[model samples]
Target: MNKKLIILLSGLISVGIYMFLPADKNVLKGLAILFFIAALWITEALPITVTALLVPIVAVMTGIFDVREALSYFAHPIIFLFLGGFGLAAALHKYNLDELFAGFIMKTAGSKMIFSVIGLFIATALISMWISNTATTAIMLPVALGLISKIKERNHTTEVFILLGVAFSANIGGIGTIIGSPPNAITAANLGLSFSEWLSIGIPFMLILFPIMVIVLYVILKPKFPDMAAIYTIKTQDVFCNKKSYAVVSIFGFTIILWLLSKPISTWLGIEKGFDSIIAVFAIVLLVLFRTIKWKEIENFADWGVLLLFGGGLVLSGILSETGASVYLAKLVETHLVNYGPFLLVLGAVTLMIFLTEVASNTASAAILVPIFLVLGQEIGHFPPYELALTVGIAASCAFMLPVATPPNALVFGTERIKLKEMMKVGFVLNIICALVISVVAYLIF
Candidate 1:
């Protein structure tokens, strides 16, 4: 279908539905705005980021709120957190540190496909716990590509699994902490959550999901390894591990320590927001001040599109809350799900979040839906509001099927080594299963 036609039809459909629904003018307006953006996003009617930027415009023009109120959503501490993380990632890449770490891990498997898969998966996951998953996926990609050439697989199964493992590892790794991914940051920022608190809850979830993801992927993409006896020499030190690089590593560790301790330290200083953004911005400054990174590198490294897209989504989420759209939606869910019990309510929320993430930005999915889940939790009174909030945030980043499901998936797909049908086949099953599993497990744990 023509992208333009899809967008036009979506707009018309939203308007028609709005006119027919017997609801308040403001409520219908919010739905129209949502449907318009969701349709454009799901159909790729525009660049996903561009569609994200358009959402705020749609809401503002539809009278959901005045310009100031809509614009207010874009300003949050998480934006700075993203900038700080991206700068660090760029600096590491510029200094060849990311490659240094990834290479060491990839070499340990010693040319065996299964071990290689596990190694790459573990490497990507560990790196992502502290940096951007997108960056991790991109950094580890060449290793996987090179392995494909060396393996000489006619079926390409081993190579395909290697790349997919890297991407999935990156995605799964983000569930470990508040700074692990944008969705996690958004959740923490909204709830005024501390790093230790997030880790306490999040680490358990990450531990549960990581092995399940690896084992299931291993089974599904069971590529036969003809050269299981092959072993490659591994290196522990290289030119990249020189004095300057070690210094950078030291400063990186310091930044992490600050992030972990910023809350407690700020409490001592009697500050409420606890210096989260302050620490992030301070880390960026120190990296440059110490000559560990350059000014142009900051500009080059920052993901401006992602930052802008997240800002736009924040705008829409604010519209949803202030205009009472989220409240209205919660009431609708309550009417329908009243008898479904807490299990179904939580499961349904998590399941909806997983599928929504497939069609749009994961961060955007979390931004839009977490507020609604919060409202639903309060409305039900028996539901654990915090658990519901965290569930939506965590599950929102679990997209695995389509290339468009998440940036890491798209990054892997762009390599041309993995096919759309292949990802869809495995991803569809995993997506459904993981969503159900996460919801059920979370229900018990929380």
Candidate 2:
């Protein structure tokens, strides 16, 4: 179907929902706008940002929020965090710091395919835990592509596995830490859990999923013995590390330290939360102020569309909260799903989130579902609220299926090394495996 027709149909669906629903007008209005936006997001009826921008438009038209309230979401701090992270990444790339780092990693991972796969996957996953998964993927992708190009006897199996090793690891890496992805921060924040608490609970899922992720990719993409010997050894650099690289290392390293120590850092600084974003912005500003990167370069690096998308999603989420739509949905879930027992309920919620994140923006998925899970936990008294929220958050980051599912997916998908069907085929199974792993782990630990 044409995108325009899909968008029009979505608008009609929202209007019809508002007109016919037996709920509060404000709630119905919010739900209508939400369904409209959700449809557009799912169908890509327009550019996601254009669809995102429609949130404020629909909110204003329906009186869900006034112009000021709706427009203010555009400059939300989370959006700034996105900018800061993107800027830092851009700076790193501008200086070829990521390349220097990627070279060092691959050189050390050695010639063997199994160890090389594990090393690259671990490196990407570990970096993703502290930075944007998109950036991590971006940094690793070129390196992977470069390596693939150098292999004179390249075949589909060897090349696909190498590219996917980085991409999949980036996705899985985001699961390990709160700063790893937007969903993690949103989840932890909404649940009132401190960073340490979130990390402790989240790490278990990561441990289980990371190894399985590597094994599954390795097994699926494993090459024949002759082809394995033909695979080129990753090239190395002897003197790439320099003053500039050290600067990248020092600044970024300090930022990670602050993030890992966020609780103590925040306490020492006397703040309630979000020391991580502060570190992100602080790192970006320092990089620019020190002439490490030009201001224009930072602008070039940042993905402003992602920031806009974040704001638009937040605005719609705000409408859902302020208008009582989330609360009503929570009660409905409580009534309908309570009888399944806490484990089953948690499994269901996380499972739903895993798929929802595939169809919508993961960040938006977290913003929309976190509150409902929180409310449901409190009202139904199944899982504790914080745990439920954490489960939803982690599951929100589990969108491993399609290009649109997450930025990391899209970054690697753009390479065209692997078919969409291949990604979907493996992604679908991994989705189930990762979801079940997370849900069961969450039930036990959180």
Candidate 3:
């Protein structure tokens, strides 16, 4: 469908709902806004962030919230946390720490193809834990290409496996931390999940998935290197150049320490907890105060649209929850689901999220669906709302079925080493496994 036509139809459908739906004035308005945004999100009629910007405008026009109230979601503390994360990532890129990490890891793998692929997965996932998945993929692509070129007899499976590993590893690595992906931050902010809290689940989730990913790809692709002895190598000494690089690494390590230990540290000092946002801000300050990075450098790396999209999602969430629109929707769907057990309920929600994200922006998908899932959690009463929402957050990143599923996927596909059919064949298998894994883990843990 034409993007313009999809957008036009979305607007008209929303209007029809507002005018004809039998509901409270505010509920009707909220539903209208929800459908409009969801349609645009599913079809991508506009940039997801642009559609996010519309949420507040529509809300104000419908009298659901005043300008001040509607816009406030954009400044939510988690947004600042994300902003700080972006700053930290910018500094890492500015100083070339990302490349150093990649080189150092891949260089340690020796000449074995299997070991090299594992190394790439490890490096991408580790870096992606702190940075955006797209940046992580970008950092690793050249390393993979360098490795591939060194072999005189390049095996097709080897090239495809390594390239797919970069993108898939980037996505899986993001499951390790709140700042690693937008969906994690959005769901965390909404559910009031602390950094450490997320780490407890996120890290374990990543750990479990990593080996599965390596095993699955290796077994399926059956990659073989005919000339492993000819693989390229990097000097470890080149990984760290000078005192400035060391300084950036020190600051980066220090920031991560603060995030992990913030809770106990707060308890010991009799300070409040949930200060990860403040820690994030402090990391940015250290970068500037120490002259490791500059304001101009940050402009090139920061992703302001994601921050705005998160805020807009929060706005819509508040309107839905406060105006009873979410409850209304949940009630309408509850009967059909009432007989299902808790495990089945969570499984269904997680599965839906995995598939939904295969087409829509995972971040946007999380923004739209997490709130609704939260309300559905309330209606079901089998589990906490946050637990269900957390599943959605984690599952949102499990999209592996299409090139458009994630930036990393598209990034790898652009290399032209892997076919669309190859990606779909492999991605479809992983998608099913991930859905099942997420569902089971969430049900047991929560």
User: Which candidate tops TM-score?
Assistant: 3
Question: How well does candidate 3 match the true structure, expressed as C-alpha RMSD?
Answer: 1.8
What ranges in model 2 sit over 4 Å off? 146-155, 192-198, 201-203, 225-242, 411-414
lDDT per residue as tens, model 3, 144-192: 8887887677689889898998899999999999999999988997888
lDDT of 2 by residue, 1-446 (tens): 98889988888888899899898888887788778877887777788778788889878877878999999978665565556667667766666665555555655776655555556677788778756888899888866776666566667877777776688888878878665787776666566565567677677777788888767776766753223421333322432444665676677777667667888878888987656667778988888767777888888767677677777877876887888887888888888878889988888988999998888778777777887788778787655667777788888877777888888888888987889987887788888888788878888875
How does candidate 2 score on lDDT?
A: 0.75
Q: Please, what is the whole-model Cα lDDT of each candidate in the order they appear?
A: 0.78, 0.75, 0.85
Per-structure clash totals for the candidates? 0, 0, 0
All candidates: CA RMSD (Å): 2.7, 3.1, 1.8
- TM-score (all chains, Cα) for each model: 0.90, 0.88, 0.95
Sort by lDDT, best first: what order?
Answer: 3, 1, 2
Candidate 1: which stretches are off by over 4 Å? 1-20, 58-68, 107-113, 152-155, 226-242
**Model 3: lowest-lDDT 10 consecutive positions:** 227-236
Deviation of model 1 at 2, angstroms: 4.4
Q: Tell me which of candidates 1 and 2 scores higher on lDDT.
A: 1
